[model samples]
Target: MDGVRFGEMQTSELVVSSRANARVKQLRAAFQGHARLSGGMVAIEGDHLLEEAWRSGMVLKTVFVSERRTVPGIVPRGVEVVRLTEEVFGSVVETQSPQGVAALMVPPVRVLADLFEGAGAALILIAAGVQDPGNLGTLVRSAEAFGANGVLTTPGTVSAWNQKALRASVGSLFRVPVVGVTASEVAELEGRGVRLIAAVGAEDSGVVAAREMDFTAVCAVMIGNEGSGLAAEWMEMCDARVTIPCPGPVESLNAAVAGSLLLYEASRQRAVSKVSGS
Candidate 1:
């Protein structure tokens, strides 16, 4: 295909119409998590997400735009832009309405120490086997909004890079540091002077209300799976367990809602303590 420049913007070089094309296959594989094993690349769709990825300084591998859509100017020079026919783009993406734009990006590399780099006291969120991608994505966004240092996902948790999770995060996934860890690794947070707080659904005799927790200090709040709640062993590792009080008929809050509430409370307390100089 011949390149067509838009004003001064760099142009696309190739138009892919075949589903069997190697680059098209790679995009699909990245979305399906196959590319992740070999190249650690994740496919992000929509123009907004692509812009967010660029603003966050992520390295873009390739950009794919449907034939009907113009290449976004935000795409940097020297990056390869592949224009795919509408049919091929539809086949490659998971969304009901393909956004006409997608890009493969390298997921950020983070270490455990990166979570605690500069903060005097850290507020961390842990996702323990959170199977729902939407919930996990919301938790990641909430973690950043509430000033959490970073998020840690246990081995069984849904990947923060999952396309559903990425889309649900509304680009906050690119802004926050999410690292995977083993259960044992999670237990080690306590060694660094970070208190472990488990978020449970209903009130228990031994558990404290979320408001009562001293969030101003370094703490990591652990949010569990949607269906089963936290594993008993994981809860046992926590310095304390806290629950949100609900007077209504519902048995529990959604995992993301519960986690976000806890994070907001933490943020509120920390802000108050900072203002009071206490």
Candidate 2:
């Protein structure tokens, strides 16, 4: 069990003892988000995320399993599987409590045009400068749950493939189209008839409340950074500024929470519009 190579391991596969092993090093780099080192593949831990990646038809490059655990049944034939010692596996993963299973997968490539392809009016969530990976991930999940056409992260927003964000998204990142674009690229959407809606704090006087806004139209809702909220640039670029009124007297809601509520409202309005038309 000690002298096994870090290549594909089966029933006869033994523990990979060397931290210097190529596969182990690759896994570490991927978890750290070194795009150059990871060959553009993203890392995901836990069986659930692994299974979700497989179910989502992600191009699984390799599955890394702890020597203490058997390779999961979800892994299809022909995909590379590497077995690592528990100690070495722990060192490579980000979680304090290593899940015994992890995998590297190629994230799906998408463009702004992809978001507008579907039949109905496009409902896109544009993350302007949201720094927190968890917040970005949650926004993607809500985007999917609320039937958004896609989620776009502009410059300064964390990457959707980030490890923490990927985990936080709970597999929705794989299903939802999360594309990265520049602020300039977003401005072009306005010309395409996609209205840009800015999410603002409740203190912004005269801004429409979430429930009252007309979200049935094609729109991109932009969530700003956690610390500074939306900058003047994005606010000015937006055709409308919408706020979520809070009776609790809080300054503002979390970025993810704000974005989720906005998406929910949009979803609700779309459903009502559909019913009315029918």
Scored by TM-score, the top model is 2
TM of each candidate vs. truth: 0.94, 0.96
lDDT of 1 at 189: 82
What are the Cα lDDT values of the candidates? 0.88, 0.89
Best by lDDT: 2
Candidate 1, poorest ten consecutive residues by summed lDDT: 1-10
Per-residue accuracy of model 1 over 1-278 as CA lDDT, tens digit each:
22323232334565677887766777899899885442668999998999999999999978889989998889899787788889999999999998899988888888889899894799999999899999999999999899999899998899888899998899998888899999889888888998999999878788999898888899999999899999998988999999999989999999999999999999999999998995
CA shift of 270, model 2, Å = 0.6
Poorly placed runs, candidate 1 (over 4 Å)? 1-14, 36-38
Q: For candidate 2, write residues 37-81 as lDDT tens digits.
A: 988878999999998998998999888888888889998887878
- What's model 1's TM-score? 0.94
Which whole-number lDDT from 0 to 100 does residue 17 have in model 2?
80
The number of residue pairs in model 1 that clash at the backbone is: 0
Scored by Cα lDDT, where does model 2 land? Answer: 0.89
Candidate 2 C-alpha error for residue 103, in Å: 0.9
